[model samples]
Target: MDLGNKLYTLRKQKGISQETAANEIGVSRQTISKWETNSSYPEFDKLVLISKLYDISLDELAGITNINNKEINYIPIKTHYEYISKRKIGNIPLIHINIGRGFYKAKGIIAIGNIAKGLLSIGLLSIGLISLGPIAIGLLSALGGLCIAGVSIGGLSVGIVAIGGFALGIFAIGGFAMGIYSIGGAALASKIAAGGYANAPVAIMQDTENIKTLILNKLPNTPNF
Candidate 1:
């Protein structure tokens, strides 16, 4: 069935006119009419609101292609290192953690093509925009939308980081989250690596001990880990 038919049927089921649906969804009646005529589809956010209005799932409303009740496109599995720990793919060695600790899980390790990684990559891009705010300002200047060619256009100098403005406003949110995750992961990796090195096997441990003993015997408190 056409989306328009669905929309028309849903409206009648709810006993509301197109005008009422439009008002509730913050769109014009003509837009609803257009949708009902199969001339266009609702924009994504509006589709979400419409789903709620009709008390239907987004998959049902949008007619998701081949969607199934058990389809798990975005399951957030915890650090089950078994999934990460061992594998070889086309001559590239796989990285792994010791189930409970290591660098392998720092960046949310998972099967390749994980949405979490994609989201992180997008977040990096949004942050790159902050660090690229000068370009946005230059475009505004070119549009003659600024007071002068480059006057207070925002996101200039200071390395594209405008303290408080539209250029970096929303991106700052994801940027902060990314920073926290990255820094936390890096720090945890450092600690785990340090602990691992301290507890390495006898031969490697002997090498480390020999190196440390030599340093201590020849030099006092002058070396670092």
Candidate 2:
């Protein structure tokens, strides 16, 4: 078989449209059609990309037969998986999950994938009302490595009430915390601060030098400092 026939056969076996193949190969659909019809041939770089996209060897793509002059058998590999629930909330699906070799974003009422955005999202990078992932941004609550929300809890957190290794918010609590009312090992606040090392107008800490107004005993109707 010729190079054009080999290309056509491989593309057919993969069950992908010419436009999809063209997009992956960084070429036009017309160019792909020309190549398949033997009107044009792919450059070296495009051939390499095509081989990788089809999960085939360069030798096989070029129609290089074995020592016995026999063609190699090719198998289609499933690289992507996606699912959308029949149940719908308005126009959006109730749940959508898309995961694969390339970047696939899942968007629905409840989405779960590599990258997700929904009412309740869970993924590596997510955004929702309630999000849980490595990096999350939630309107109400977020819990992840790095989080931003109304109430956030993570390694590095920022929210109205933030809790993490390094936290910054209206009410912050962490190893290094900064806010109006801060509480941590190293706390800095404008109003009130309570920690081992605290700095604020009204500070409750053991270190008197850092405290502007030291409160030795806990104040009435105040949290335990």
Candidate 3:
């Protein structure tokens, strides 16, 4: 059976409502409903949490069981070697291990499920030059829940140029910002800052008169509120 069926059966057995499950896992009720209906799958962390909550092994949740069958007597050695060892799709490795290559040409490029580490990687928790995932650690540009990079954007961000709900960088913009040049609701900066409650050498309140010129001069590229 698929994961959805397994989850439904498990929840029904436990006599738990979808809302209870959602609260336990920090997700919306709709997210739980989606997982139960096979509309979507939970993240790796959520799956682990769910498995623990149900007091079952991950293998059981995935519907994997021990079984043996005697069908073929002789298996080719080369076939086993080719399929199980250092397999590649064109230049990119399909199932990469320690060292690999993705769609791009770069050394030490790993693109696996859940975790990936390489020059340009993509996965749930990825680390690379241009990483894209739920939680990314890209040196140049990163985007996720809590990101740190040269240019970062997320709920909580730290970078050279950061933008998020709470941001810290050389140039930042967020609800609660702190940087060299900050612009947000509660901005705190060293040089120039603009926000409702700003603190800096050069401060411009969001409601201050003639603040447009200061904003234009300090943060010319910042998006309009």
Candidate 4:
């Protein structure tokens, strides 16, 4: 049966009027009527409350046929930055390039794979640089920004090299922003750039060439991803 039919049956089964249900749920009697008529759907939290009131599980309340409704599977595909709430540290929003993956034993904080990925990218850059391959060095440099973070890394050389046909004067290193723009320099970045990827400060740099993604680090809007 539909939601309206189910609602009507449930209300009658409880021996309560729409007015009583509305009052208990803190909504107007008209709201209940509209719900029964299927004119609208209940808000998520309200639905939860209503389920509890009726002593029913959410799926039961929504009349779901499937037992397992694993909705809202969110894997963050972008970079996030936030302020350290306690102190107003000029709070340059930070992004992790995800170099390696392993749970932190102490804090139990998930690095979200950024640090691990970043480290791997940098490692490739080192190998390429050592082999005197500018193309390989440029490849890692472009994808290396998501791996860049921490003021303590002050001494780490970001060895950025742009690989494309564009002249050097057009692009210069400007922190993470500079690193992303260099994406087009690598042969792979070329495939990405051709697809019309615009340049933005990258929060996450996907596998693309000459295409740079920029993630702006706003103070309060720091992303959990």
What do the candidate models score in CA lDDT, each in turn?
0.37, 0.82, 0.69, 0.38
RMSD of 2: 9.3
**Residue-level lDDT tens digits of model 1 in 127-162:** 111112222222112111111122212322111211
Residue 14 lDDT in candidate 4: 88
Separate clash counts for every candidate: 0, 0, 0, 33
lDDT at 149 for candidate 3? 80
Alpha carbon deviation, residue 10, candidate 1 (Å): 0.6
lDDT of 2 by residue, 1-225 (tens): 777787888899999999888778765566679678776566566779988998887777776663356876432333554556667899888988766565668889999878999999999999999999999999999999999999999999999999999999999999999999999999999878889998887777874563422443333345435
- Number of the top-ranking candidate, with TM-score as the measure: 2
Better of 2 and 3 by lDDT: 2
**Arrange candidates by TM-score, highest first: which order?**
2, 3, 1, 4
Off by over 4 Å in 1: 65-225
Per-residue alpha-carbon lDDT of candidate 3 for residues 57-103, written as tens digits (9 for 90 to 100): 66566555412332223211110000111345566544433212222
Superposition TM-score, candidate 2 onto the true structure: 0.62
Worst 10 residues of 1 by lDDT: 177-186
Compute each candidate's TM-score over C-alphas: 0.31, 0.62, 0.48, 0.30
What C-alpha lDDT, on a 0 to 100 scale, does residue 164 get in candidate 2? Answer: 99
- C-alpha displacement of 210 in model 2, angstroms? 17
